[model samples]
Target: MNDSLQVIPLRHVDAERMMELISALVSSAGSGQAQGGNNQLKVIADTSSDRLLVKGSPEMIAKVQEMVNQLDTTPTRRLSGLRVFRLKYASAGHIADMLRGLLANQSINSAGATSTLESASLNDASSTGAAINNAASDSLGSSAAAVSTSSTSGTSTGVGGRPFSIIADETQNAVIVNAAPELMFEIEDAVNQLDSRRAQVLIQAAIVEVSGDDATQLGVQWALGNANSGYGVVNFNNVGASATTLAAAALAGTSTAGISAAASSIAGALIGIGDSRKDSQGNTEFYGAILQALDSSTSANLLSMPSILTLDNEKASILVGQNVPFVTGSFTTSGNNSNNPFQTIDRQDIGINLNVIPHIGDNGTVRLEVSQEVSSVVPGSTGNASGLITNKSLINTTILADDQQTIALGGLMRDNTTTRQQKVPGLGNVPIIGRLFRSDNDSTQKSNLIIFLQPTILRDGGAVASVTERKFNQMRVLQLVIDKNGTIKQLPLSGTEGWSGNVSADYELMPLNPLIPKRDQAPKSTSQGFTRVDSPNSGITTYPLNR
Candidate 1:
């Protein structure tokens, strides 16, 4: 590492802010306004006296400076003229890798030698011998079956095995590589590439408890089946399992006519009494398994429970009245809530404190505290509402309250709107130069800003499992760009340089697809269900999902 190699970490907020600045810079640079004209607001030749002065949008620079400032509690002198490397825009693979790693490490101990790092890139990486050896035999066979046993001696390129190499340029601080796998496969392979002997040694060094559905059931299954194929197991297929289903006779409301009529209004009010199974004919079977468990008098009583620190007796009484049983870990023990309303799961596996109030006799009724800084107030026409509204701001306001899946950055013909605020650069805001450069210029759009960052080192302080890099410098603007407005617009970051759509297609990253499926619920039409057809070659039933 070089002595001047400055390191920086960016949070969600910093990324957003940096993006605003980059967009502004790109817009300004593309516009002819950046040229030295009568519009006194021309671009600045320089900002600081540093020989290697770094320049970027104000928000981008500010965010980087802010992190450095906060982390610098040391007696080091004030740092200045530092080049800002802003990682504003990231690919889907990047985002997915980050989220996956964060969610994967949430539960259990992540402090030992076996513990993985919290950061990763989403690009496919080259495969090593150990990685190929770690994959499940099925998945491995699905990819490269020619891979045979790796040798324990020198060179180790035995029969049927592929000799992969990762060349690190110690002089240039870069890596040269041949073809690499996709990001998802890279992550899958990297973990599998570790030496079993080395892994066991590290596991022994760190007495960490690795327990969970993924780490236990899936882990054991994958580990046991393919000792030669080293790999991690991840699955979300728990759709039709018998252990969790209920019986029809156990259903509460499907009984006698006269007695059923009397209980008709509240018949379906019992818990664990829902249709648990769905047949091929589309019929559902609800059982009373959950309801029976709750009706028993000897079962755990809510009255015997003590009130939580954040909840008063009034709130605690509601839990008893509602007869709501605590539900804990579902997807995995790592993301479980232990049925406590006061704790909600975070992507990082940490529990965030929350105050929940349930409605009487309702299992789904829940009202979480919206206010981080809660206060008390009265309610009336001229007075305060029943509850105080005080100063409360929500995080990630970019996402809708009803559904967080949608994005709301801007619309076409975007004018001065409160929602579509563009971040400007500090130097671009100077008196004479400010007017010449608007952060949202849309004339020339061929320029692009590149960003780079140091890779994450694992906690074990050993070699990283995987690596990825993007050619940000190669990013070129296209003549036609779909702006936030959803309309085609042209823009430049510095001046009147416009993109002519002449950019080579080879420079573009892979086209992206919608992360989530277009529709959530099955279509009302029966034809929307799976269609079973006899195999052309074999007489077997096969159901293909509706495309």
Candidate 2:
């Protein structure tokens, strides 16, 4: 064995692949020379920069050089300035896996001339019959398989696979991939197919929660769903309140009879309750009984209670009385109470008034002015005239685009109801006698009302036409002159006209009637105020006299 080492310089061979080959060769030489002597091949590789250096015994150096030479003989292609195609809607991992699959498929079609990194390492190691090196190669192949499985399964952290790097350059709005040029062409083809398809615009929607009573909620839902109202698509969801809370609010003057009515209607609709041929009076009695039972009992308990006939008119009236004062001969005197009588009596009523002003601008701005007024009879008060609660709200604002602007039309009242029921302690439990022993009382109150407003800008044909007209008005006009012959002529009256010479300068004037005689050639006038003229250049001249 020689004591001196040999150095081999390799070119065009990947440093990583060269190092793996050298390590395998050194392992083989070490194991093969272990039993014979202490002389073993020492292999060291310097892979910094582009050059790869390998130092080992002559035989080991010869083996590595042979592998490099074999690699150099294989067919290879080079490409530059190739762009990486990216799918806007696809993820990076998805693109990476697709490229990996494409490479694998192409390798298979080419009879495996281009082997995977793991397989190549295994083949190079197995070429030499060294037990330790073969075992190491097997272990390396297993680890590589595990890593490839993890990467293909979409668990790798970086942009692309281990073999190449795929990066997204947001500044250029493109992706850059470093890989074999031939494979990049395949990727470009796939990406071109993706780009040929059209992209879709997605609509983003939101779910809004509106807190209100049944009537107001139904009205808003209907308005939003109506096509003629121009509010686009809207969906309504009903998440019912707890029965205990609903009943408590109803009984505590915080909820209205409308709520109970709505709940009953919903319950009846759900259960398929049908109307029968019952008289109006009988129907009234049926509803009255239901209300009475529901007033004192829970909704669940009301189902178990037996139905009964009850009369509940639920009518209310008001009376006003006042003492009168009499005036006799401009002197006031107090009148007797018996002589005075009640003057006026009227039922309480609710009044609502609405006013709105909308100003639309040519610049796509909208200004809105809204006013709302509400008046209702106050609860737990005497006399219908003086127990009125009036509320008003005014809003003025400007909004842009199709964005929604909400104005709180508050101060409108929500009817609050208090339900009171009187019943015998034990007899109310009786099936037939319960109706006579139980009575229901209900009172009313008022709470705040909330309103939501969403305004949308309608850019119809007229608006578009106006915008186009404004744009047209902003354009500048270029002046030009046209001649009688239907040809455009340049300014300054150039060529063949008397004013052609230096248009900026003044020209000599010419007489309209140059044939007329001059003052020196004309004859002098006589005492009769008549004169005759003759000129050598003129043909004839005449004069007329006036009386």
Candidate 3:
């Protein structure tokens, strides 16, 4: 349907009516008088100039013809179409200048690069390096050049008489250091640093910036064959890969209570504190887990996963006992029962779950800053306790770039032991001799310490006095962007897309409004044509379906 139409100004036509007419004309023409007959329509217009170009078929021509007849008596109105916006940056040229200035002010290269090569060599052109060293040494003080070899056995000419040459083999590449060895090393090191820096930049760009094919490849690489790593619980008793016994492992130790317990821990880890992700005390929650659901081989695979925060052998065993679906194996003990009473531990499955805490964004997307709360229960034992102490003080640690950085609002908790003591006194008796004789075992603290990462809106505590619960609730959602340098920045996503840009599915934009209804996420698809059937009993004619 490629029919064209030309029209003159009309006294009766208005912009709205003209648009409607054009739409009808285009639709009628494009249908090719085939699919439901004559329903084709496609038009392009220049919005600002009120210029219109219409294209379609015979029926569309007839429709436009009717519109032209009406327009002959009406006033022509301006046409509106797809808008082409010319974005004008407020400080376009100045942005570059400003960035350069900032870079200069920060002395961009001053931060010594982090990674380096273990050992390396550089190309040497002239024998200037050898000559310079000779010039400094007494042996060749007045000589034009000097001879040297990487290996002690190789011979070299003395000073000025001959053009001194150095011999090197595959084992080592010699640098004719016209300067001191120290200076030569320094130059080589610098070159290596540059190479490492370039590689790092390329990797970061590939993983973080580019989307589509490159981003998918990076994600696949990150996950790799981790799914089939056979780490979960697939290898108990060396079950055959295709054995029917292997399939039975899923239900081996599964019980409603067991699954519920695991789900609880996962839920807790995911839910953050309070109205926002922050807890009552205002901190971002982070969770970790160690799975024991699989055999040693499978355990190793599970640990290899990037999501793992920690993975001890004991934890893996517990996970196995619980019978998580992803893992499969015989839930029976096969090892010696005398040494390890838990030999039945193999047959009698167990599991350890890491809370599924929401990960706060690290980049400049999060508008809030939070102090995390970490719980530790020493489980008052007669012997010394070994547990991590977090949130007591900040420590230096590096987070790898491949890890997840999504903000979540949940957590999980699981109890592995049932042993309990009613009371214990003098739990901290002096030294070895006191411990043996101490029977006052009342109120000995027991149980695991669960540390949750918390998020907070206040950058500094001073604003806490002015903050109301309503305001806090209003700021619950957050967006963040993180760079490889470990710099965390908060970017408020309350407005249009914020740091996430125009991509709709990448992130969920939730505004903290108590009164508004919760957002619905349903798939949207194109609708089919309208129906037209009247009441059979009445036999009354109805109007045609126009839209």
Compute each candidate's TM-score over C-alphas: 0.13, 0.20, 0.14
Per-model C-alpha lDDT, please?
0.25, 0.35, 0.27
Candidates ranked by TM-score, best first? Answer: 2, 3, 1
Deviating ranges (above 4 Å) for candidate 2: 1-16, 19-55, 58-75, 78-547
| Candidate 2 lDDT for residue 168 | 40
**Which segments of model 1 are wrong by more than 4 Å?**
1-142, 146-154, 158-161, 176-392, 397-547
The residue-level lDDT of candidate 1 at 253 comes to 30
Supply the TM-score for candidate 1: 0.13
Better candidate by TM-score, 1 or 3: 3
Q: What tens digits encode model 3's per-residue C-alpha lDDT throughout 72-143?
A: 341122121111111122121222222222211211232221111011232454311111101112222233
TM-score of 2: 0.20
Clashes of 2: 0
lDDT of 3 at 75: 19
Index of the highest-lDDT prediction: 2
Local error of candidate 2 at 319, Å? Answer: 57
